[model samples]
Target: MKDPIATMKSFNRQFQLGKPEIEAVEWAWPQEQGETMFHIINVYTKAAQFPRLTAESGYRLQRVGGMILGMVN
Candidate 1:
C-alpha cells in the first residue's frame, strides 16, 4: 500500500457501514528500526466478531506486506 493510512481509512469506512459490531477503528504508525510500522485497532461490541475482523484485516494488510503482531485486549 503506497499510502497505508489512507488505505486503512477507506477500508474502515467501508467495513463499519451498518455494522454495529464494530465500535471504532484506530491506527498508528510508529517508527521502529528506521522502518514505519502500521498498527490497527478495531474496537468491536461483540467478541464473536473479533475473529472475522482480525482475519479480514490481516488478509488485507498482508497483501501490502504487513503482518499482525498479535491481538491485545
Candidate 2:
C-alpha cells in the first residue's frame, strides 16, 4: 500500500496511450471481516478519441464452506 500513486504511474506506463489520470483514491472497510479495500477513480484520455471516466475497486475476501463470495464492478 506504499506509494499507490507510483503504482498507478507504473501501470499507466504499460499502455502506449490513453493513460488514465487519477482523480481520487479512497480507502474503506465495508465489511466485518476486517479486510481493507481501496477505490480508485480516473479519467482516460484518447480512448476512442474521447475522454472516458472509470472507477475501480479491489479487495480480498475469505472463503466460507468452500464458497467464495465477493462483488466486482
lDDT of each: 0.35, 0.24
After TM-score superposition, what is the CA distance of residue 62 in candidate 2 from its true location, in Å? 26
What is the model-wide C-alpha lDDT for candidate 1?
0.35
Off by over 4 Å in 2: 19-73
What lDDT does model 2 reach?
A: 0.24
- Measured by TM-score, how close is model 1 to the native structure? 0.28
**Mind sharing the TM-score for model 2?**
0.28
Model 1 weakest 10-residue run by lDDT:
27-36
Residue-level lDDT tens digits of model 2 in 1-73? 4554454345344432232222211111111112221221121211212223343211101111011112222
- lDDT (10s digit) by residue, model 1, range 20-69: 22221331233211122233432222222334455655444333322222
